[model samples]
Target: MKIYFANGLFALADRMFNEVVVDKIRKMDSNIEVYLPQENGDINDKMNYADSIKIAQEDNKELLSSDLIVAILDGDTMDDGVASEIGLAYGKEIPIIGVYTDLRQHGVENPEKLKAVGSIGENPFAYINNYTIGLIKMNGIVVNNIDSMLAEIRKYL
Candidate 1:
């Protein structure tokens, strides 16, 4: 199964998803392919926001070609570009498996919730809830770990 990863690109969280989680998934199944935006996408050094969006568009196109998407929704809020990629996957009818490590960190018990002291005025729970609605509204699956995400993909594959 081809899995497109949607997550932050300029932080340690992104590295964790790519280095540890994605690698673990690859090791679990040799046939599974993971797609991510190329490095140098950050606007911190040379690239600007527009350049980053351009890169995201290219990557999203590649992701749209994949069989499914496994997104990392660990940040306080969903990545804007990642949300756009999710939209593309939705448009293509590709199954999405959202992987969130911050599930319990924000007082969230399940995929549908909000925190007591919400951060960003919305909190991580809101992010999960929005993504869950988007995924379920499109008949996609949601998971909180790399293993579970891979397992869900396995069911369809």
Candidate 2:
């Protein structure tokens, strides 16, 4: 199976996280092929020069041909490139597994947390773009952690 791994690649931590997750996914099955954008240094290398059109065309080609997309939605906001990839994948009918491991997303049952929602600037919950999430849920699902994400991927395997 071809899996498109979409996530932020700008920060060192983000790039390392993407690599670790992709490694785990690849280890799940030898037949699985994960296309991590960071791996394409030719286009993603900051020191090098890759035009916007070239970058989009290259990544879009892999995205469109993938059997699945594993999108990381853990950032402060959804990474723009990842969001666009999700949209394209949704339009193309490719299944998506979104990994949203934000810690603030927890504590649903805490009274203080729930009550804080009514207070201005005191809300403890994190907000992700509902439209992007909706698109993912329409054709696939959003998982809270890497374990759950892998579990969902196993279903396709």
Summarize candidate 2's per-residue lDDT along 15-122 as a digit string, tens digits: 899889899999999999999999998898889999999999999999999999999998889899999999999999999999999999899999999999999899
Candidate with maximal lDDT: 2
lDDT of 2: 0.95
Let me know the TM-score candidate 1 reaches against the reference structure: 0.71
The clash count of every prediction, one per candidate, is 0, 0
Who wins the TM-score comparison?
A: 2
Candidate 2 residue spans exceeding 4 A from truth? none
